[model samples]
Target: MKIAILGTGAGGRCHAAKLLELGHEVIVGTRDPDATLARTAPDHMGTPPYRDWLAAHPGATVCTFADAAAAADLVINGISGDHALNALTAIKDQLAGKTLIDYAVPYVYQHDSAHKWPTPWGFMPLLDPVDSDSLAEQIQRALPETRVVKSFVTQEQETVVDPKSIGGGDHTMFVSGDDEAAKGRAAQLLREYGWTDIVDLGPLVTARGLEMYAHFHSAVGLALGRRFGVKIV
Candidate 1:
């Protein structure tokens, strides 16, 4: 598969490495490819720069967002929640009829000047009207012609690359999308990454729950005092 991951940050690099390991041709997409490569410091999440990860994964290459999306068989929206909407919206034309795997939560990153305390996962606030709309639904609405499947938003970035590290043997993944075939394709990729218990929670609107579930996932992280995930059981 010619897979394009939209973002060279931790989640993107992790997924790109896994895809390459699975023998897929991976192109990592970013708004500014050069800037992403030139990044010398670790990201806010503490993952090493993309350049560092790219050094280990030689098979994967970097490209502008448009080029990556235009050349891909499938596109993974691994971009951060804050920037995902604008980035994907701009390239909706190329995404038509293609399956897009959305891994972003609906939270927008913001500095907490008033309080030093942070949410369980980290400090961030959700975009407006979250009760009525989800990030995945918004993307689906914005790109009505494209098939969008939402998954992987509730896990830590490490779990995306390696689901086995989570102590829970049956950690579950909830996928939501309007297109069955598209959801199937997304599930296949998740299976390749070793996710066994995946639940298709109906159509795209169900993403409201999947995205909102991040808060609980974070609470689990807090209890564990480490990165964590969820399980249906």
Candidate 2:
């Protein structure tokens, strides 16, 4: 599969690396692909330079957001939730009829005046309040033609990539989308990444609940000293 991953941040790099390791062709779309690749190359295991990476991997190519989405069989949105809508809207036309896997958390940035104690030792999801609608639902509403599957939003990057650190147990992942086939494809990808526990929580509307899970998870992480992931045991 030719996958285009947007954003050059940790989330994007992590997803791109995993996809590349899985033997799928990957194209990383970013504002500065060359620079981003150079910075991230060393840390990525078995990942070649962006130019060399593209050459070594058949059908893999990186370009700006528009071209990337236009050329990919699958486009994964790894951008922050705050910028996701705008970024997709810019390339909305190119994304028609595409299977888009959205991993976004609408996190409203505000100073924690209360300075909640007992914060987790590791990273936690910072959720945005006041947005009554979930990011996935909003994107689907905006682009009805595109098949959107919501997954990979509940856990941190490390947990998604290497589940063992979180206890090496069966970790659960939620998939919610209006399209069954798209959800199935996403679930397969999750399984390949070593996620043994997966739940198809029904239609896209369920994304709202999944997004809320991030908030609760964050609070718990803050309460505890560790980022112990949630698992349905």
Candidate 3:
């Protein structure tokens, strides 16, 4: 499949590299591919610069967000949760009839005095109302033509790439999408990537739980001093 992964950050790089390994024709989408190529700094997760990562994966290519979407059979949205909507909206015209796998958690930025706990990612509130309408649901509504599947969002960095790294891949992943076929496709990719346990939460609205899960993930990370995925025993 010709896949386009949006974003050049840790999430994007990890997902793109794995897809390339699986023999998919992967093209990464960025707001400015040219500028990304010029970046010398490492990603937030301290991974090597994206240019270096790209160099390692010669099979992958980069292009503007719109162009990448236009050419892909499937699009895996690896853009940051905060900016995903804007990025997809810019490329909306090209997404019709495409199975878009969205792996972004919508984390709203609080600009008011209610500044919350400080984390590695920044100062986001400890609790927010992602349930009113999850980010994935909003995206589906905004792009009525696209089949958006929400999966592989509960993890990040290396763990996002290989869930098996933790608990021997025994942990579970939740997938939610209005389109059943789209969820199946995303689940296939997850299994290809060595995910042994996958949970179908049903309907795109179930994304509310997935998006809210970021809080639980972060809390456990902070409490235990490490990242842990949710598992059904």
Candidate 4:
């Protein structure tokens, strides 16, 4: 399968490497291929440069966002929350009639708050479409022809791609979308990633809870000083 991961961040890298190991052709999308490869410093989260990661994984390819989307049979929206909308909307034509598994949270990284929920990284970022709306719904609306399924938002990035590392893979993952087939495809990918328990929370609106769970996930991670999994039992 040709899969396009529309970001070069740590989360995107995790998916890219896993997909490659699964024998899928991985095409990673970035704002600028040259700029991404030229970076020597780590990202804000201290993730190593793209070039360094690319060196470790030789099978994966890097290209512009549109090129990657155009070449892939399936697309994964790993773009950051703040830039996902604009970046995706720009290549709407390429993504039409494709299954896009979006795991982005609509987080506004910069905000003014009198009181904030502090974490190991800093105050937790604010969710833009909190309560009433979700990033998945927004992307679905933006690309009406694309089948969008929301998943992978509820777990830590590394644990998401490698569920067995935590709790012996005895946890649950959730998928939400109006399109049944798309949700099925997303669940199949989760299974390939070693996830045994996947719940299909019907309709894209349920993404509100999946995304909003980020705050609680962060709080728990900080409290535990490590990554953990959630089992729906």
lDDT of each: 0.84, 0.77, 0.84, 0.93
Cα displacement (Å) at residue 106, model 1 = 1.7
Candidate maximizing TM-score: 4
**Whose lDDT is higher: candidate 2's or candidate 3's?**
3
Which is the leading candidate under lDDT? 4
Candidate 1 residue spans exceeding 4 A from truth: 111-124, 127-129
Candidate 1, residue 5: Cα displacement in angstroms equals 0.5
Report the C-alpha lDDT of model 4 over 163-227, residue by residue, as the tens digit: 99998999999999999999989999999999999999999999999999998898888889889
TM-score order of candidates, top first: 4, 3, 1, 2
Worst 10-residue stretch by lDDT in candidate 2?
A: 116-125
C-alpha displacement of 11 in model 1, angstroms? Answer: 0.8
Instruction: Show pairs that collide, candidate 3.
Output: none
* Number of backbone-clashing residue pairs for each candidate, in the order shown: 0, 8, 0, 0
For each candidate in turn, the TM-score is: 0.91, 0.80, 0.92, 0.98
State the number of backbone clashes in model 4: 0
TM-score result, candidate 2: 0.80
lDDT of model 4, residue 94: 92
* Full-model lDDT, candidate 1: 0.84
Candidate 2 has which clashing residue pairs, if any? 106-128, 107-127, 107-128, 108-128, 118-222, 119-222, 120-221, 121-225
**Candidate 4 worst ten-residue window by lDDT:** 114-123
Off by over 4 Å in 3: 43-47, 113-115, 120-122, 125-129
